[model samples]
Target: MMVEQVEVLVVGAGQAGIAMSEHLTRCAIPHLVVERSRIAERWRTGRWDALVANGPAWHDRFPGMEFAGDPEAFPGKEAVADYFVDYAAKIAAPIRCGVEVTAVRRNPNGAGFAVTTSAGDIVARHVVAATGPFQRPVIPQMVPHSAGLRQIHSADYRNPGQLPPGGVLVVGAGSSGAQIADELRQAGRQVVLSVGPHGRPPRRYRGRDFVWWLGVLNKWDAEAPPDTKHVTIAVSGAGGGKTVDFRRFAAEGITLVGRAEGFQDGVMHFAPDLAANLARGDADYLRVLDEADAWALRNGVALPTEPEARQIPPDPPCVTDPILSLDLAKEGITSILWATGYALDFGWLQLDAFDAKGRPRHQRGVSAEPGLYFLGLPWQARRGSAFIWGVWHDAKHVADHIAKLRGYLDYGAPAALEPL
Candidate 1:
């Protein structure tokens, strides 16, 4: 028996879920948004204190509301959380926080879903899995465990002071790993940054933020997801936005190492791919510069030239001849911060709407199984589909689909997402 019913049910009250509610309300759809914890809980808890939004303020906001402060400044983690909270309040979204959806199953007797939650069971005609990406933290299975070294995933990392008084080794070269390692080293701790496959995008180009360049070039909406999903971005928003230069880091004494490969008694081994990885990243940086310059020339957009935009140096000797192994005790490294990224977990979704790798199988978030949808997936619709502004567009598209299904309105042919 259904205790309650609604036209649409949105899961996870993060930016994606909240965006869904906004569009649903606009379409006059009767729905409710459910969150496992408070709205934007991850932003409030799962991030480091020193973290800032990866995108600039002007580019990463909803179309309706403006973020307070300088438009070019990157809002800190707390401010970003507050922005979502304020957006929810402004829309008067019908949201119920603390209602955790444990399982979702198709209604065997009808065209709906039977959802079991911490609050109560409810039947929804349409279910939107707006859980977003970054579902679960993933550490490599090969990472050895030892009581001597304090190990924690990036989600659990709060600050450099949270760790013991010793050197720190941050594994992975993504945004989170690089930021954390920089913090540790700035605090006078010996830090080793494990290099991996990463894209080095310049923070600024041609007197404008790189984000502006991406929008004008349609790189955000025009690009498609690559075959290898392991490539993480190397950029920083600490003091405004800046390129993540490993060469500069090496010059600054933040030792660069290869990907973490092995661990033994009080020791960790790395691959000899530091030079290769840096070379790959340098190539990526050059490619962006080349493309941006060409685009300007083609469009005849005469912008002020940025000098450092084309001044990336080759790898220094430190980056080329990196330490292949680390004896933790000998190096005085007492902490291992794993910024290894996340894995998808749809264990509660009792639907065959996923591929073999557990990635959602949906065409622009509309599942093959009718009435089921996914939102806020990375590259679900395009490169920008996972960003804050991108989520707004995706949610509106989904809401339009729901409205059209119930004869609310007609939705035209939107952009077709590529098949995964």
Candidate 2:
């Protein structure tokens, strides 16, 4: 096997990897980005058909690159993928697609890393694991295996038609879960959205998008939450975006249930916390309003005052006293969309920088293990570290560190594609 050597090796071609490449290129550092599939592969294939970026295009994009048309418009899933593809080309990123990294181990001879990939072995002075979050789709263990119910993770869900005939039970109220559930309901399918603890930010508040409010409030750079519990945000970008109101959803006949507890005797049980979950979500929304209002007062800018913190549709019966359990067959729910989210899997990287949870122990992408680095991890640096706008800062920091390494190898020529 031929061993390709480089100054730095980037293990993904997604936004983080590309941003890292851009900064490295600016710093005149030679590096190669390898991807398991094409650039922005997840955006291209993983998300559902109705998926749109949570943030508006202007906010979601990389610096100096702009998504054409309305800046506030949330780009569709395919558009986001195309944006990455175009951005990679713009930087002329030295990326090899269709090359899958199987494992990574320290170079036994001396320093750096020995990366084993599908194509061939590669040695690098430093390795940046730019594989952003969402590595593995996860369904909670509490969800039982029922013979008739087709369980689908958000990653595999493309459209409602792809699901088996009958109503849908979307368990989990995260961004993906909430959006998926709403999409199903809008398609005229019966949907029971299981509510959970979540951050509810109104799509438009005080004559500005949520992105603007977050920016003005400096919430983007806020410290990442201590816990790694999956971030469940009740916000949407469908139909030009709207405030995700579970009350309205309940009032409209979509059943709102509490968190999934367990399964017994062929029935899925839900917790009795629907009202609490809804209140928490509403509280988050109102808190945003309070902060925004305070900031306006301090700045002496008179913004439209919402006498009501936010419009709260009357609490429906489903939210107050939710259904505790439902037999899959009896409820006519043929499919269960487990938007429970993903758990990061770094099992391939033979490094000691990770905690017991398999999360890299890094101070903003710079791993404790010298040559090994991580980028685009959730809360890797700040609240924004997980998004495109924030990941660039982390990438620049990592690239700058890599630039200060002991030695620099000459830029290697691009490798020829081998027949797989």
Candidate 3:
């Protein structure tokens, strides 16, 4: 009923929201961050308990805050949630948890914006949609309604013990699917992983983490094409910095299937592209390694030689084999884990600033809608725009723009705030 006014309103209290909030705080911008649930809700509840950050702690640090423990060690999901909580407190972020934004629209007078939330209505001079890109779980429409089998999205999966006592079919061989299949297999469950196009990078390459090399090669800054499909890299800490590629999965006796097509007549159908997918993945992986090696050599960075050359494992023999369909009952698979990834949902945002695909039309983080902005979106400015370490630069840029717009402070170009 009553309206509250603020200089800026940031929606969502995840890593992106917190990062943007901290920057705004530094700029002395009056703003409030409202979260639908607790801070870092996805890290707290949307991930498996065994899930650790894909990258090391040092690379995952938000601006002005570093991980207190071992920098190279990967922090688990709970640890990540705690880090966000601590970071929020340390920055003194004006955040109101448990408050969900219902709708957001520009003011009729074209002054600022009107933000409707579960708590109350707020008129803000600027609104930053800091909600990360992965907002909704994308379950394939072809998934059949099987009465005997339990189906769950990767976001809802916690552990192997949660599922019934039977085999598991993990659909989609992305990072999550690969890791989940590995976890289930290690837990003594019969696991079958549906193969798909992915990037299979080794956990560590040449005494350095693959992520470190990616950083060195500035791969994170690489711009993706506008219609580029998201590719998930198969690397996890569950196996102690181990790579979870299809070859390794096959070696571990996990059944590999082709891309999941659909379910028909109580049987799951798959495309007969297993060989092509495996070949493509292998080629891409080798290309990436070659590029990294070339970059290191060009930069005159000497890599430590192994006393004994590492023996690369042979490619899995199952690539040529293709299983077109499988009856779940016959295969004894009682559960299906849909690691099919996520799609962004900005339906609540009442603005014409979005493209045809529902993504905000913004340069970096600033939108043409004036007071409207976006943060933590995939390929927003660069390849790493959606990552924890990557969002800070965009946050700083958005904060600087907001401050300048409000006539708070002139911090010159956004490039001036680049990390030292």
Q: After TM-score superposition, what is the CA distance of residue 155 in candidate 2 from its true location, in Å? A: 0.8
TM-score of each: 0.94, 0.94, 0.93
Cα shift from native, residue 96, model 1 (Å): 0.5
Candidate 1 lDDT, 1-420, residue by residue in tens: 326878799999999999999999999999999999988988889999999998989888999898998998999988988999999999999899999999998876565888889998888888999998888998876655644788899999998889999888899988999888888888998988999888888888778777887887788887565353557988888867888888888778888899899887777899899988888898888888888888999999998877666776777776667788888889888888999998888898998787787777888899987889999988888888888999999999999999888873235653221211
Candidate 2, position 189, lDDT: 91
Q: For candidate 2, what is the TM-score?
A: 0.94
**Lowest lDDT 10-mer window, candidate 1?**
411-420
Best by lDDT: 1
Residue runs of model 1 more than 4 Å from their true location after superposition: 223-228, 408-420
Instruction: Give the per-residue lDDT of model 2 (tens digit) for 112-223.
Output: 7788889988888789999999899988876556465788899999998998789999998888888888888888899998888888988887778888899989888888
Deviation (Å) of 297 in candidate 1: 1.8
Order by lDDT, highest first? 1, 2, 3
Off by over 4 Å in 2: 225-231, 407-420
Tell me the lDDT of model 2 at 348.
86
Which should have the higher lDDT, number 1 or number 2? 1
